[model samples]
Target: MAEPLSSLSLWPIGNCQVSALIDDAAGLVWGCVPRVDGDPTFCALLGGERQDEGVWRLRLAGQVSATSQYRRNTPMLVTRLEAEDGSAVDVIDFCPRYQHSGRMYRPVAFIRIIRPVAGNPRLEMLLTPMHHYGTEAARTTRGTNHKRFLIGDHQLRLTTDAPIGYIDEGRSFRVEQDLHFFLGPDEPFTGNVAHSIRAMEEATELYWQSWVRGLATPMDWQEAVIRAAITLKLCQHEETGAIVAALTTSIPEAPHSERNWDYRYCWIRDAYYTVQALNRLGALDVLEKYLAYLRNIVDRAAGGHIQPLYSVMGFAELEESVAANLAGYRGMGPVRIGNAAWTQIQHDAYGQIVLPTVQGFFDQRLFRMADERDFESLESVGEVAWKMHDQPDAGLWEFRTRQLVHTYSAVMSWAACDRLGNVAERIGRPERASFWKDRAAKIRARIEAEAWSDEKQHFGAAFGHHHLDASLLQMVELRFIRADDPRFQSTFAAIEMALRRGEHMLRYDSEDDFGQPETAFNICTFWLIEALHMCGRSDEARGLFETMLAHRTASGLLSEDLDFESGELWGNFPQTYSLVGIINCAGLLSRSWDTVR
Candidate 1:
């Protein structure tokens, strides 16, 4: 049995906490538990050193093959096996979530193990736990039985009443036959499969089914789109509403190109889109949780300014440190920890936060004068945007090389002012309304005058440069300009000519004279799809949408970028923003088609 490079071959069936994939030929079950940051516990995508942090592998014999699916909407995964010897086995896995009593909480994370019917098929199990992001080794000890190991400040307890056999390694263990593993901070690990496994299987089936039934999606792309949404929801930090950019880090931006970047932290820009997508799906509970996170950002910033990204726990000032000791995935050098884009004046971030905040107030009717807390949140965001209106920013791409007065940044700055004006008027805040409206108008005039290039007759990447950028696709998506506007057409043409790579597009080409061009960004491509829809190119837009969908991996996963020449995914696997953008863009394009038809 061998591992297939295609993700489509891996079956996906799990809840927000963990998604399990089964390899039929290998008879191996793989699962990913969303971490506080973006990385997964089982990182088979990264390979070698980045293979997996915590693993549970079971080997089945007798020429057995497997098939699996989720137990409804619950996190429970069920894999069925049939062997040549006419034996069958049902393997179920699930982590009991914090959702109960109509609320979700953290800690006491539970992973239930169940085997409904053992077909007397021989199976071998292996469990491994790596510490400090797979950088350090740990010690293992046992109290006469159960496999117990401690790493750093945490202890893992593996308990199974099954006839468990063990093979000892220095830091890990290889278990045989029927056994179970549990990991946590303090709880003594225990699992009695004989009785508990059956109960767990039934309970898990009911849980997921109930969850799926509660969803209110419009039912257009229910299967693939909802699955993508569920995957994004799972990537969220349960303790905090902060969502990560992806579940794995250091999967090179280009194959062997030294372009890998850590995408674990919460990006303010990503959160804005996430709110829109979730709100449209009627997932108000999740939306409000994220709004609470946003309010926390405003309270902490206090008009000083907010970082573009933050830790899962809302910690700002992400230090871009590297883990020098650990061997990187497939020898990709200098694995990064924190993001340096936090402090830069990516002025587009201002609009990212403000636009969604305004949308919340308007669309959801979330703000009221009587609610002091809501007013405070709006005021905090408005005041910050007003203060930073004139400052230079790094722009939408968050270019690592230099800071420039990016045209996209100006567009967002103007948007922030525009949204504040609208929200203030709605809430009868005259003072704020008048000031923001005037500010927005002035910013708009300046953007048209300064960001445009007379020589090229198109929008420039920044205030002075001649280069174009796909970020301007947002100009139409955000309603900054109408689809029929001649200026938009010219700008779109320039961007298509310059940034488009094959069927996809990029943020902007580098300012330098040297080095090869990188792959087209996945998010920007969707931005183009939306722009096309708005421009009255519905047919073209739908064609592009299908083209983009074709790029999805075998398991319906997308990366941050794609190699233009080779058609291989570059950057992290299953990028959250990319998938979310696809869903949103597809929805918009479909609606446009319906309207035109």
Candidate 2:
């Protein structure tokens, strides 16, 4: 079977509402319909004999070869396949997303425009949209120009310019003029489908290019930063501003490793880093939208309690279960649906929630600046951090079987109170500032006293164990400890000693529920890259960052995990965390703007 997730070289196109991963052959192999979290309408990415259930394939009757590329700087993908008879078809796949009306018209749709590129090409279209994780295919009925598919409570209409009989009967026909298909809601398509798609393509290209133009790129590594930034933006759900961790789930970290888990939900820690990275590029549009998402989350948590992750729609309950109907990535079993980590007590989220929102209180350029009430609402988060700083829960790792009083969690908790105090002072609330300042100081004292390992001369993963983790690098980021501090330096060296694998870095060297990790977590390598720069290893850091850049996919994307030994990407596709790493490292290590002259 194909390693559908990483193999076949999948390219993704999304409108922030729906996303699809297509194979180089122009097959709609992996995509969820209606929404990113919805049931798989194209589930062939995860292996199964059920290709007729959740996949769309466009092929020439005698097709022998294919190649793919994205349109210049835009997410539009073009795949050309040449048949043995010297005939070819170019498949253009994109999700229609441009400003429609006064608001963004990101309807749930996948648009494909196919054109004959060579002599007498014959095209065959197999659109098998499945429901309930590919357990069954939907019932289809047809009109003169459209086919309506009924899947559970949803109705999908596939409007096209081709002969309806040819599509319904799977008949191969001679290629003629341009053919367009729009698979979305069951409503009637208003105008000429082909003309509308052509217009949407032009508008979509303009939208992406214009968005790219606003990015504040560094003098060096301009292309890498742009691609990474664009991928990160695609992770955001435009309807609600919640950014997902990745577009996929169940892509294992290593071969047959059940480390395969769902990454379709929003993790507070991941979103904070994403915003921080985009904020450096002056993409306050993302940060500002995310701040609103953060505020919604905080408001929904009327009490002090909060989850480490939530659905893209901001729902809290995400019960995890194995999808028995489908095989996992590369035929790995037990593909998972919802993430269980949402219930884990990752205390670091408190800091992350406050960290991004605090920027709004100070940044004047934002249209909707945060006010006094926002700061007060944020204090409630600080109080939770103050209460939970020393308590034991799942660390950022989300260990399925164990819990520990993680040093990283305590420091982040301290950061929460620390930022709260800063925001309070900025808003002229001296008394509130004093209160949070005192709390932050006390939390810092506890972290300093308990998390330190005198024998090892470094901080540990937890209060007792001297095991070093790459997460400790955030000590400098959270400002809990200065980078030059001997303790932090020792910790950095210690983590590198244990977790560094040649040019790559692992989250840790220890065993978890799935046994020891065989692949380097891609984001951890970037953390090491940033740490090296801060520690005055600028040349080594630059060399390492460039090496990591070489590992990106053909489309200039990264996954959650990397097999350093083999130089193969693993885990979920187009991981936002990995993309954030690229943006952050490029910004940190780029040559000074003054030297550009």
Candidate 3:
């Protein structure tokens, strides 16, 4: 039987195409195939209490304990499982992704290399894949050296050097030699299994290390920044250049809160933050590809409407549904599939699109520079931003119950017009620059007049309300207000008073659609840290950042939320937003290289 779906202590391995979540015991608990938003082939992560199937586990007979870590700068995970007799086995897991032919060759494949490192080890291989969101097991057939799993027009073939019969029947066998397993598309692997996999591993390691070598990492917390950067890269679907919010869906924000929602789709707001953080690290490849995705989205919008989220393939309309078959994370139930928020009105998206697009106009290292035609396309999005600057929508938190002119949304709209003005000036269009700058000024004036609350001496969550939220801290980051401005300082102080919970910070203290959030939003906490630094509280910001770093999982990554009191990670696995926070905070707080040099 597979182990029960336990904690969020999971490690992610991917190739920018597909990803998997491996538990501490080296079990492949959750993985979606073909793409990040596809079916959950390994769905044991949500298989309720005591998952019996839908997992791929290399079990060591008489296993005592297991420990796992990443391979330095890459997503290649190395897990060491020790038996009671001191015999141990090292399980190396990775998805094959490296440069090949004349282009990048990232296939939908997973590779596992098992080697005995200590005394004689006994191994049991259990490969069970589920179909249709864990409703049924994938029917299997076997050959002499490979096993094929059939799932509704799609097939996955497992080519291995281990005894096929042993794996098919789930029997324990003594491991006297190394074994390699390649589970990928339903096609023949063209060479010697052992030699080809080893070469792929070496090439993949080289690819990631070389990529890391090019990063402009911070002087301190370099490892944490690198890990977070790699995790963000994994969340991106390179085929379309769209980045998902998180790898898995239905991992509740707070346990039993029924607040679970699918995060596998691309959010314009999230991707903007992602590109911004990655751009800080000098990772332009991701920025270039993501800009391509944004252009497509802008072109499709045709200067009018824009959604908050879209499928990784640029498709709209994600009808949210529940997976009745799977029990949920830790048996919490109501495993959701698609996101309903894609249909909601999130006016902040216009600014998100413009914020990242503006970078393309000025950056010289990019292969393709933004031209007049690109600016014209961006103007359409800017028009929407102007139209919706004061309009009510779902806001950034996606409140399902009410609609209001959120301060964050209006500020983002202002940022859109503001950046367009900058882009226009960069492209030598003084007339257009003046037009956008005027609109931005008008929006800024309105925000300053209405969003401030004299009663509470802080900016409200919405235009006329006095409720405080952590997103108000974005005023400095978005350039809406000077950090030293008295109003912003007062706003920051008021937000800290209401939302600060010990070392963590909440998105808000009041009730929302979910009856008050039960945990601290990870990215919100990072926003507070950034706000503290900007407010001239450098020491306090550094201390809080250290506390947040200490709360990351053993894999040096965070999810969407963290329990304030217990410090346990909750929400979806490998959240791009939380990972972006790590990179951004590290870059902001790290000492200058001159000091170290």
Candidate 4:
């Protein structure tokens, strides 16, 4: 296996409906057209012998190098390709997202505008879209000013101002008028290509800037928070409001380790954290959207039993399978689609589903505040949590080879009932509130009695399992146990002793279905920082937070795993969990805005 030259110089541009990842040189290295979970239209980043097939590249005939950046406060990406002879071109890429008609019109389309910025710059356009994950080429047909690609059952029309034949042949052409390309629906582009694209670019820019203005970000690291918030927002499947775990999947957690798993689906745990992170910045649109998603999910559950995850479109069944179409990321092989975790009974989800949606009952600013009907639906989820709080199932680490009454799951279940109690009161349901509060008390009492090891003087991962899991740090965050509690203090010490490796922390060092994890789980480290801050180690937490910031890619993004020793990023790209960590830690450690004024 070989490492990709595509540096994590990876940048993202999207309209809520679709997302595209571009390389530093303005090549569309990876993207799921029409939808985030849809088939990959350009998948070189996943790796194979035929990576060039699904890629879209804009080559400056004699280019030396290029530099890229997002237009401030917008998803628009610009790449300046400078040729050795001093000629250059600026390639601007964005997916139009703005208000049109009475509603938001975030089309599942990508728009690229190219213009020569320096002397006589020449350009070569190469767009080779593939189907079935690069197993077959897309059938093509040419039109007057457009080209249609028959990708699987769908027809994608690419309307461009550049000569169709010239683009198809990858021929060098002198730069003249600004060239605009829109690849989306099969419907004919109804307006002038250049004019419509220009208008879209302007509107999209204004849309993102205005969206950012609404954020109540911490005074420090506002840019990083905004970017992560925007990326998190892009993961949302707006039609149903399901938030995906990440944009790309099957990127191995560590090199050639069989850890690559599809992440384009929605996990209750992941969506909860994603919602919580964004909500902290006052991004209520996501919460309001996801709150409806949760309500629909609970409405469909049988006896209040919900799976760990679901398809972004809210489908119940997501049978896992491997795609033989292309070799895995860096040819690691066994590219997987559809996560099997969807079938697992992760008891933690009952709590995860409850935590975010309950906010609507209390928050005054929501357009459609939750009502008693919503509370009825949520009470069913709490019922499940009460029934399974101590029952065996997959824990948050999602171990496949074992089942235990995971302490984290019990803790989350406790949180679910606890918050429901608070929400029931807010909604004026005194009897329901007392019922929930009593159940929450009983769950918490059992967790303390069974999960705590008096001899070890620390909390274990499960009822009797002495193994340390980093999730113990979440106790403080959940308010289940105060950071200063002696039990929590000892559990925190135990986790650091058992899992911490220098500045990094592992979720667990125990071997699982795929052997022991070699890299540090990115978010686990953030949990440690937050734990440290709450425990009055604020200076140390601040120092570690600074160190983690230095580890972010040029894009200020991170994947799921980082090398505990070398700090190399691995796992799914633009991992939602990892980005949420950045947002949370920055908020936790930054100096207060009050002193700024």
Candidate 5:
């Protein structure tokens, strides 16, 4: 029988370096190695009908049903499979991450422990890995207790205690005892495999639980917030402190929309929102590391210019191309590898840099405080924001063929100058504060005159247009305007009437390069919820929040897009933008701690 196709109903496990997606049946479907943006070592999620090639699965003979769940407050996943004859087996999966050798030990490895719990069971281990974007199978070599797969120039070794002959020949065997498998670098295993794996599992669990314990979670929806927060952390590349937008690439925004693009790289705009959301939970570790990444980016720019996105290693050139060998999500063609948006001129990036960097000056808890030298570097970013406030460029949405002075971009530019002024004042640079505040005032006046649509009675998507966009709602969140301000209220009313589709919200109603969008962007819906709460519609906001929460997958996570009509998830898995929305909204709408105290 053929294996079933993959879906968004998957769980994520990572250690801030390498990550993988597992299906309910405990198949390792998607993962990248060396780094998040590296080659897909397990490309089964986009492998189409040929998924049996690039995947690792433990098959239970006569399998009847299966169930899976994450260990509470951690990314460790436990899956149980029951056979027709009442036989069962438990599969515990995780990537090792703990304190070892006086440093954080996070290797690019996957650990699986399988133990039979019920009647005598038979198991078939299918561990076929592919190379070069699923174009060919990985060549294999064997040892006494392990097998090595030559993938591209690198080799991945599978060190297992299971019957090596059975796994090597893809044969079914009796599950008479516990089994352990470690797939990682081609190195010798020193310690006893069983004992080392068990100890790693315990330490990894403790590491995650202790991290979660330190979070200042809200009074309500604590579980949901923690899951989302962990998912966001999984998206970050700790070595570089860069947070990616999503884990997979080329998952269409809608069925056959052809709007697929790679999302493994870090977007300045996305990273800023990620740090802002994590900061609200007092997860300053992420913020502090991200600030370091931001400082490097700003220094490289020399306060002149910055790209919208970059590779996880902070490299600039990410030439876009298609991997025709592998099929896309659900056999959709054209799986993209690198993102072209890295070259687009997204003016909002300046603000994204300044917004998060300014936090370092105010937060006293960070290990390294921002000094005058840091402020000097930030002013270079502010200068660019002031210069580009009204310049036409690609908007945050990255419209390929159009260039416009977008309202969102201009607003962010204004925010850049505005925040620089605050930082200057905090650092006792009153003269610098006055200078930036003046520029901010001028930019605000220009936006008020150009972006506002007099005929539509609302702010437009871009200057001198009457189009409604979900991003306009961000004005309130960015403090560009108060919720009660008449202009903002009118803009909100216009947007609600135009972009709201039942419980979901569209990024914009206007057609784009790919025609009209067929699915709702998840972050846009959360933006509407935030707007509703800010407008004093607490009941409406709470109800809508509940509806959104109900849309999360069994793993309590969401993707980048959703089929508003069917509520099925689409786009990439474990979207950082969507997860950030969960954290921000929960902090906003959850019951106050005073209620319980």
Candidate 6:
């Protein structure tokens, strides 16, 4: 049960709480609370010397073998433990988001479920929510109609519908059996105990089920697709529809590398492709909201400038800050919030942001609601698109070192102009159409003449560098160049030859790149998937797609990078952008497979 002491992740069907078992031998960590990124309340992940934050353990129980899983198509988590006494305890966990409970940036509901599967099991409940990753303790007490606790700015209110007993530990309390626990911060849940639980569960289920049904994927890989789908939905900040890169912030690319970066904000570039992927899956309700968010941002900027990323609520003032109190993930230090890279201008971001909005507008049937106002907002995007060619700033990677005329950036700049021209021509804006066409033609000419390194047989990462970048592969995807175009073919081949590591492709071979340079970028690999299909290597593309699919973790989760040697997922877990890439690539491959058959 305990392997030199480690952690295990589990999902139980029809349960909402995702449990991470810290000590299987002791059966010490049980009935865990709301979520993974939540305040540990009970965590041994941070430090040691028998120190853990908040945990409810079955203290009287001895060593046990445990397994956990979620109900099919639901967030419910059931953790099963078989004890040394031949007794079994089934902990059913769920924190149902109540009706209209999906706003991700706000404090939300979390449910814990417990049931006796095989035997009458006795359990001890302990609540210890340590502040700042268990660095500080919350003041605790029992209030009328509420078990209230506060630490600095965080206020926790626990309400139980059943009779409960409590003992105060250093941090939280130990509770008796037969109780339903409701845990949330200052943003209160509606009503008390049972009413709140029912509402939250109904809302969360409705939100999730509605999303799942909308996806067009069949049952062949249904569970995998559903898990991936939920992960993607979780990333969307429900209020603004700004899809965060991930829920957690400041997880390092490499342990002790100081390469930590905050990804909670939405990147303009990531949003574009994500929109396309969601559109392909027929998940446009959320996609349209995101597009509207982008529209609002464009209107607000008024052509002054657009950020490469923004906060979940569309706040543009995202200056990076470090949380010095909490220890970094695995000691990869400097847990940061807000991304400084927001100020860096990635020219490709403009096209990536605009094209997806346009594509989603036209392709997804859900966008049948497109009206004159939508088109007007799009015209504003065209005005912003024109700014791409004039700007020379950091390219797609948002590199901190230096800014250059990245060829991929140029390709995207060209794409924005070209897409704007298409939209303008369709909407009868002939003058605007002509202007965009002229700019597009110029971008094409500039890329062919300046971006190509005939001597190196490929396009450069940046103009005159002669180095290949994985992003140049986008030239084909964005139609900056035709798939069979000699330059594009040569560039793709060159990237495969130079940047390819086994079946995976690297972003670029920059020495300054972080994360040990051992893994392929999840997004870049997906780019290769599309590129392979475009270049008529359909079989190879399909094979690589299958291989990448195999790389997903056992729970159908995927991280930002794949360690080639050890095959460990690195960077953030359940990365939405990477999964979006998977959807786009899979949809393309599915189409290709149909064509071949």
Q: What is the lDDT of residue 424 in candidate 1?
A: 76
lDDT of each structure? 0.63, 0.87, 0.92, 0.87, 0.91, 0.63
lDDT digits (tens) for residues 1-597 of candidate 4 = 122444456888888788999987888988886688888988877756655767888888778888998888887899998998898889999998989988898887888999788888889877888888878889999998999999988889999888888887778898877889999999989888889999999999999999899988888888888888888988888888999998888988888899889999899999999999999988889988998898889989999998999988898888888888777776786788788887787999999999988898989999998899889989999999999998999899888778999999999999999999999999898999999999999999999899998899999999987888898898888889888888888899899889998888999998999987899998999999998898899999988888888888777788888988888889887899989998998898888988878
TM-score of every candidate relative to the true structure: 0.85, 0.97, 0.99, 0.98, 0.99, 0.85
Candidate closer to the true structure by lDDT (higher is better), 1 or 3: 3
Could you give me the TM-score of model 4 versus the true structure? Answer: 0.98
Per-residue lDDT value at 103 in model 5: 88
Error of 6 at 587 (Å): 1.9
Give the per-residue lDDT digits (tens) of candidate 3, residues 1-597. 457557889999999999999999999988887889999999888988746677898889899899999998999999999999999999999998888998887888999999999999999888889999988889989999999999766899999999999888889998888899999999998889999999999999999999999999999999999999999999899988999999989998998999999999999999999989999999999999999999999889955589999999999989999999888998897999888898899999999999999989999999999999999999999999999999999899999989999999999999999999999999999999999999999999999889987777889999999998899999889999899999999998889899999889999988988797899999999999898898788899999999999998999999999999988999998888899999999999999999967
For model 6, where is the 10-residue window of minimal lDDT?
6-15
Q: What is the C-alpha lDDT profile of model 6 across 13-95, one tens digit per residue?
A: 21222223333323323222333334445443333223344344433255367676655565555567675776565655555
User: What TM-score does model 5 achieve against the real structure?
Assistant: 0.99
Per-residue error (Å), model 6, residue 381: 4.5
Cα misplacement distance, residue 107 of candidate 2 (Å): 0.5
Per lDDT, the best of the predicted structures is 3
**Clashes (N, CA, C under 3 Å) per candidate:** 6, 0, 0, 0, 0, 28
Worst 10 residues of 1 by lDDT: 167-176
For model 5, the superposed segments whose C-alpha errors exceed 4 Å read none
Residue-wise C-alpha lDDT for candidate 2, range 1-597, written one tens digit per residue: 122342736788988889998887888888886778888878888865455547788888878888988887778899998999898888999998888879887888999998888888988888888878867888899999999999778899999989989999988888778999999999999988888999999999899889889888998898889888877888888778899898888888888888888999889999999989998888888887888888899999957677999998899999999888887676876789999998788999999998888988899999998999888788888889999999998899999789999999999999999899999899999999999999999998888888898888989889888888899999998888889999989999999989999999999888888888899999999999999999999999999999999988877889899999999888888799999999989989999888968
- TM-score, structure 3 vs. true: 0.99
Which has the higher TM-score value, candidate number 3 or candidate number 4? 3
| Better structure of 2 and 6 per TM-score | 2
Clashing pairs in 3: none
